[model samples]
Target chain A: MIARRIIVLLLLLGALAEAWPAAQTLVLVVRRDSPVTDLDSVTVRKLFLGVPVLINGTPLRPIRNRSEPHLDEIFLQQIVAMSQPSYDRQILNGVNRQGWLAPSEAASVTRVAAELNANPNAVSFMWERDVAHNPNLRVLRVLWSD
Target chain B: MVRLTHSLWVRMMSVVLIILAALAPLLYLGVSRIVEDGYQERFINSVRAYSRLVADQLEALDAAEFERRAGAVLDGVVLSGQVVFAQIVDGERKIHSSITPALGAASPREDYTFGQSPDQVYYISHQVRRPDHAVVLRLGFDEIPTSERIRATQRHVLLAIGGFVAVSIGLALWLSAVIARPMVLLQESAKRVASGDVHVQLQSHSSIREVAELNLHLERMRQELVGTNEQLTREIAEREASEHKRLTLERRLLHRERIVALGTLAGGVAHEINNIITPILLYAQMALDELPASSDLRADLQRVVESAHRARNLVWRILTFSRQSDTQAPSTVFALRAPVEDALALLRAIVPTNIEVVFRCEAEGVQLTGDPNFVQQVVFNLCTNAHQAMRRDGGRITVTLAAEEDPGEPQLRPGRYGVLEVSDTGEGIDPAALPHIFEPFFTTREVGEGTGLGLSVVHGIVESMGGLITVRSASKLGTTFRVYLPVAVALSNAAGAA
Candidate 1:
């Protein structure tokens, strides 16, 4: 009975590990009414990295989490194809060239979702699991696969 | 009482102190004012920059994010212990602050304002605009630090002013010494000069030109005084030597005058005595011829012999009067009338017949303490001068003798005097020559006609017998010589009886 119970516990632990999201999996989202339904990898990278992007004659505004290490790593590695420091440098360079703020930063996922709901041209990144509860937001692009 | 205000040092120091006293407060106020202005400008600018920075940060944030990070933002902006307080206020009366909530409850209504509390804290409030609220950033600065800075600057200014005043006083004292030293030395030298130190020499090496010139003038005056003193000494010595020589010459001249008087009297006496002696000898021979060798008529002839002897005795007395004695004879009480009569008798023999010789003895029995020969000689000399003076024009010669009591004569003391006055109505002595008439060899007569010793010898004889002789003469007027002899009081009664 002990041997059978140990085998069952190992199977349950493997299933729970399989259900969690990968460390680099981040989903780009926008308001449900936004004209930008989907974006190419280059367009998504340019929009989030402080470069101006337009879809269907409407400009896109970028949003970010203020202090989420996992999302920042995923976005820098999968979309920008640069290290975190290099990606930050690219964002600062784009801000200097464009003569505007790079992006609006939110303190948490709820704040990021609310920012996106309020602005139809706004864009942000979050965990795939958290996007299910935000009904006013839509997934624009997936940054990395599990 | 001497006043301190009159002192040069006091006056100089007072002026310096008054100027310094007025300047010190002004210097402190000026320095403090400049420092306060500088500190106030810097504080206002710093406060303005801090307020603008906070307003820009707030404008960029949403209401929810701003609410979440407002405390952290104020904490980041407000330096510990430097910014005394800081605050932010929302429209619904929700206030956030680094300080206590009660302290930051009211936002300043104005756009910008400054306030200071009694506790020496300074507050600068700035209004900021926001999307959902109005924010106020009230920053407090403790005034103690700024005040301390201003006070430090004032202290430095006071120290600088104090040093300047001290230096000015030292310079004034040095200048006063430089000026007063030479003046004090000059005053001392002048005092010595006033005290008759004519040999004082002043140094002419003063740095000031006027002082040096004054010293030069003082030295010149000293030299003049020395020269004048030396000249006066030389003149006094020369005058004394000249006076001694004059007195010696006067004594020698007096001796020569005596010899001249004796010589002049000897010739006249010899002629008169010879005339008397010839008659006596003739009478003796005549008597001898008229008498027999041994007759009774010889007794009558004896009377002629006695008369001849009396005539010879008179001749011997006339010869004795002409001689000068080496030693002074002792005085005796003698009747002044006798001397006057004897002098007249001698004068009658030689005086010309045209010149009347009158003798009046009004002093009846007045006696004098003097040599009889000297008295007679005085009368004879005066009569001889009178006779010679009148012989040319044949005028009258009057000899009068009188007794005087307390005669107020300038040359004679107040006493009873036997006064003998001889007057001649002849050519008078010149007014210019009157003062020297009694001097030996001082004569107005021709060389052979008269010897100058006549009046001088008369003056000498009268003075030696304790008498005074005075003469009064004028040009073309008659001359009178008056002799005053002191009366002999002891012999006056005896002589009066005789």
Candidate 2:
């Protein structure tokens, strides 16, 4: 009976693990030396979608990450409000019109954070927990919470 | 009306005006259509660009942020003077707008289209897509201003057309003058020719070939007419000269016939007078012989015998003058001065003292073959006629006897002859009576004053002796009678053969 109870508890724990999502927080981050202190949701969305957003006459440069599919999906759903393929086509159109394009895809979260830390005007999104201990990066806004 | 139709200027102007009238309206309509089409295209492009700008701005915002700034965004579009009543609506609800209307009021069609409101303002509407909703943008424009611009352009085009037509008419008139100038000159020259002035010369220096050719032909005709007129004038002068010569000959023939008729009548009358006179002369001479000499009765008888002898001599003279004597007396050669002197002496006693008689014997030794009494009678009768002619304005009488050769008298043969001329300064014979002066009983004197037979008898005596007579007279000038007698040598030779 004690073994059967332990098996049930383990099974219930697996179901609970499957039922609850992982703790995922999308944060808008920039270099610590950036003039921007904070951004609204609309401004952050505008920046990712290749739309130019200026803070005190300074343009924000956005960076994208390719290593985390889950974070990318949440950002696309909350900020871009379009499918991945649709957003890619929009970016292509923006490139043809001589607008700004996302830089090279970041290889990892550390690389994304490092790119934000290197450029004062650069902006990107990452998990809040991953950036929590870093002092070299700034949290510009919260893009999504799950 | 007739003159107006004929004017070249008028006709050319009319044709130009008609063409302008026909083309003016068509040009206006085509220009107006092009202007309207171009303006409409430009207006549509501008409105579409405005709608696109509004859509891009709205699309970049969240629903909540769009609500906060929609009014400001739309107000900026409306202030651009291209839009009116811009609105952002989602489904049946209005989020923001330039102006508010009742909810659920149907928005205009969102596909770019034009409409007119009740106030007569023109508006265009377009639908723009936002992230969560569709926005309706209505743009109002004042059509009156654009229409006014179009009308002003139309008026300028019309004025330009009118100015062109006026210039064309003026050019047409100038062309007409250039073309018709030669014709006007030709008409004037032709009028002069018709009025008998053929000397008019037309100008041949014309630009038109036909007009120059016509002028050349007219010049040739004028030369021909001048030649014909000169020929006709010469012919007329020659005809008049011949006509005058013919009339002179006709008068001479009529005069000769009258003299011959009177001679025949005088011969018969003289024969009767001679027979009666012979018986009275014989009886008176026998009575005178019986009476003695040295007694009173004897002297009276002697006077009667002498008177009877004188009467018998007068009868014989009349018979000879009338050409009725049975025995013809032979013509004798005598000094022509003797008869002329004798005639002047007798005429001086009978003429009025107001008349002066002068006798001239130019040929003192000139001789003639004719009866001396007959020569004396011709001189006496011519002088007597001269004295009678001058009785009204008593003037001079002249008797001249001379010898001439080839006197050119038609009846006198071409030889030396004695000429007796009698002249008087008097009221001369009338030209109407000159031809009839030798006719028997054709006298200008009053009745019973003198016999018209005096000149006829003188003509017969002169002609029977182989001589001729002619007379000339003029009014207020004088009278002259010439009697031509044959020379003694020529008459004797003529008589010897006869």
TM-score chain B for all models.
0.47, 0.48
- Quote each prediction's TM-score: 0.39, 0.42
Decoy 1 TM-score against native: 0.39
Error of 2 at B263 (Å): 8.7
What stretches of model 2 exceed 4 Å from their correct place?
A1-146, B1-137, B163-388, B394-435, B438-441, B447-498
Q: Write the per-residue lDDT of candidate 1 for residues B87-112, one digit (tens) a residue.
A: 66454555455453344345432212
lDDT of 1 at B344: 85
For residue B193, give model 1's deviation from the true position in Å.
2.0
Considering the two chains of model 1, state its CAPRI-style docking category: incorrect
lDDT of each: 0.70, 0.70
lDDT of 2 by residue, B1-498 (tens): 989877766676677678878887787788777776555445544554455456556666677777678778877766776455566655566654545333223544222222334433444333434555455444444445556666787778778867776787787777767666776787788788778887788764677788788878887887788678777877787777667656655666666665665556665665676576566666656766665665567676667667766655544444555566565557787888987788778888899999999888787777887678788888888888888888877999988888787887655667788888989998889999887777666798889886576776687787778887888998998999988888888554564476
lDDT of 1: 0.70
Clashing pairs in 2: none
DockQ of 2: 0.01
